[model samples]
Target: MPAIPPRFSVTPEEIDRVVATFYASVREHPGLGPVFAAHVKDWPAHEVKIAAFWRNAILYERGYDGNPMAVHQEAGNVRPGMFDPWLGLFDSVLRHELAPETAAQWSALAHRIGRGLRYGLVEAATLPGGIPKLV
Candidate 1:
């Protein structure tokens, strides 16, 4: 059987670049910086892990082995409102680091995943009566 090719035009090196650049911007972002800083003590390791995740997502590799939704839910500080700013920053990084068509493709995939993650967070935080949890 033949191996499946990467889904898009991005390379592993490009994924690394995008992950590094995006996280750098995230570390400086007023809305996101503190949240990440609270959890990620080693930026290099986090970037490598995230790069592997992107590789797994876009390239169909098996390098990443974590559940983003579960991690975010367990974090207790990852709010649904944070997805907008996070996606915005990620889109900007994709646009700046990749070709126009590639960026669009990746952004579409990212937005879909972000929406799912945000929905999961919201659903997990809601009460049985459809009301949001105050805590």
Candidate 2:
């Protein structure tokens, strides 16, 4: 079995802080808010998921085990354009809250994760033979 990397050094507060900052950026982003709003209604609960996601990503914490793309893709939510900026904003938030090395390490994994999410989004957004019809 692969050895776990050193336990992430950030506290929960720092994790929450990163999430808060990223959402603050997203709410202001004209491209992001509508795409997010069209799919997600409750913001507060979503924020909590955001924190859980980051903690799992950065720390190998087990709370977030869902296939990132599968959930988003299967839901048929998420605009294609929004994914890139969402990732950019997340990296910016992490950099603002974390040490340089921490930011770099986390950012790399975030990119890989985001790419998976992007594939899911693309799959959802571009269903063939007209928009997907509910069964």
Best by TM-score: 1
**Model 2 lDDT vs. the true structure?**
0.74
TM-score of each: 0.97, 0.75
Off by over 4 Å in 1: none
Which pairs in model 2 have colliding backbones?
none
**TM-score, structure 1 vs. true:** 0.97
Task: Give per-residue CA lDDT, model 1, range 4-90, as digits (tens).
Answer: 888788999999999999999999999999999999999999999999999999998899989999999999899999999999999
lDDT of 2 by residue, 24-127 (tens): 78888888777677766877888888788777776777777556676676655465566678888888888888998877777787788778777667656655
Q: All candidates' lDDT scores?
A: 0.94, 0.74
Off by over 4 Å in 2: 1-8, 75-77, 123-135
C-alpha RMSD of each candidate structure in angstroms = 0.8, 4.0
Q: Pick the candidate with the highest lDDT.
A: 1
